[model samples]
Target: MTTSTERAGSGLDDGPLTIGGRDFESRLIVGTGKYPDNETMVEAIRASGSEMVTVAVRRVDLDRSSEEGILHHLDPDEFFLLANTAGCYTAEDAVRYARLARAAGFNEWIKLEVIGDEKTLLPDVQATLEAARILVDEGFKVMAYTNDDLVAALRLEDAGCVSVMPLASPIGSGLGLVNPYYIREIKDRLEVPVIVDAGVGTASDACATMEQGVDGVLMNTAIAAADEPVSMARAMRLGVQAGRLAYLAGRMPRREIAVPSSPVGGMLD
Candidate 1:
């Protein structure tokens, strides 16, 4: 029997996470928001061992006279910056943000989010798909943030999105996989990467999400809102790795009756 640690070390974890023809070693993608300070955010990101970081274009202070900015904290050479259209509520607004992100010298990689309601922050599927098509036609590698609707996910994929990110729950609700079956269904049908994007509360939530056989997870509030951000970041990193290893190793079947771990005939009567 191969131990989980041994299996993880034996090159079973060697496959790079490929999306939009880009490869990443780490499957956990962190976001640059809600952190108390830039230094703390940087530390948390480094501790998480995340290779990709998502930034909201609307939140950036483009008119700042100083050179210091979120971009300064995130080294482009070390991290793949994923510019997001977080505050955009319509297809046109999302497209405009994508253009602004491109003009900021970030590549055409976009995390497209078209929100419908301020209360729930749930994605507007129709608008999201519309923006995705527009962005894809303009040569952007779109990673769409959408609701956990399988049909909508397929539509986004058909619109040429590089990845389909279905929400586990409402944004920042910390609800944690309210409808996991839908996510699994989306993963089963999609050829592209399927990433769970929101409502992960902690390490276990992330672990559960990964064990669903999805490609990756993108989270912001979970780590930032933790009591100790850096420690939480480390926990998330380990949880993601452990969950991926467990998925690859294959879990033992659950039984309704008690089963002996050792040989049943070997015990004294």
Candidate 2:
């Protein structure tokens, strides 16, 4: 019998993840938040091996001294900065932030997030859809962050979003795939990339998301809040790669009856 480990090595080079006409080999998309310091953030990001990093537009001070701002630490050549409309509660606010991000020289890519409640931080589906539609029509490549509602996800896709990002749980909750069924359903129905945006606590959470055949994951608190952010980042990177490999390799089915690993007939009683 071929073991799962033996099969995992093949077909790893599945090809690049293309979003909004850009191709990236790294499927892990990280966030710039909740870090101890800027130096640590840079090191952790480097260790994560993520090609894209999400930045909260409202949090950035564009006019601040170069040495004091987050943008100074992130080299554009090393990573693709995905400016997100985090903390925006309304469609207009989200849209305004996207424009500000673009004017700051981040370009057309935007991660659209419109929070409905302060407690759960769950996305406001109606406001999210409204913002997404407007952004898409305005020529911005929008990656919408929405709840794990299949209908909402479909509507976002219809609104011309380049990718649909569903939450595993509430943002920063670290609940880890609260509704896998919904995520799977979204993936099955949508043609665009389906990325799990929030609620990943550790490496295993990320691994599980990738095994669901998601194109990628966007996490912040997971790595930033870890005891060792750099080490955790590396773990997440490996977990994502391993999970992707396992998914492509196909897992063995489980059986009710006991099955011996060695040859059953040849074994001595």
Candidate 3:
């Protein structure tokens, strides 16, 4: 497969939109998980040019000698921390963790996640929607992660979420997109920003989602788990830009017959 650089020319696409009153330069959001170390995560985030990065919150381990050191590596001023309620099982639990994030001085930007199953890592749609509604009403900019279910996505939007991030596949599967038609349909019906989160394996997958006209992408394992995390992050950035540009540029119509631009028999006639 051709690299994004080979497929798309060299240039930066237009910057991000001011969603929920936050000014993000790049539309590609990254997660700070599964990297080899904190330093590598920082490097990957830098290469990705992602202004918003996700961080998960769980019960504090009192036995550990030192703190978990998850967000300590990241410079808070430079990165907008999107704290996630990943381990929460119910809407109330997720809401409590979200409140904790706010108390920790990380603003109200949150990735609301309520897990229903451990095996599949699928979110509880009812719990997620409940948490999203509660968060939005409480003045938080909620970005709910859910299975690639169109009705669930619409429900989140109807609950007043600023953005709805539907998973392309299972969390951490690196499967790219399993059901793209649903994603396209969700994007068409929802007025809020639609982000393709989770299950993105390569930069091409990111580009494909953008080409489908989604507002943004939230990728994690694809970058953090890659052999060269930094390079993969950079590739994802370019791929996203290329995809967005292609969408805006308007694709050419497909034809049954090839149309030659060069004239035939012009020299010896």
lDDT tens per residue, model 2, 1-269 = 65655445434447788888899888899998999998889999999999999987655458775586677788988899999999999999999999998888867999999999999999999999999999999999999999999999999999999999999889999889888888989999999999999999999999988888889999999999999999999999998887787777677897999888887686676
lDDT of 1 by residue, 1-269 (tens): 87877766643755888999999889899998999888889899999999999987755457874455677677888888999999899999999999899888868899999999999999999999999999999999999999999999999999999999999888888888888799989999999999999999999888888888889999999999888999999999988887787777778888999987788786787
- lDDT per prediction? 0.90, 0.90, 0.87
Q: Which pairs clash in model 3?
A: none
- Deviation (Å) of 189 in candidate 3: 1.5
Clashing residue pair totals per candidate (backbone < 3 A): 0, 0, 0
Q: TM-score-based ranking, best first?
A: 1, 2, 3
| Two-way lDDT contest, 1 vs 3, winner | 1
Poorest 10 consecutive residues by lDDT, candidate 3:
6-15
- Clashing residue pairs for model 2: none
User: Using Cα atoms with residue i matched to residue i, what is each candidate's TM-score against the true structure?
Assistant: 0.93, 0.92, 0.88
Better of 1 and 2 by TM-score: 1
Q: Show the lowest summed lDDT stretch of 10 residues, model 2.
A: 4-13
Error of 1 at 79 (Å): 1.1
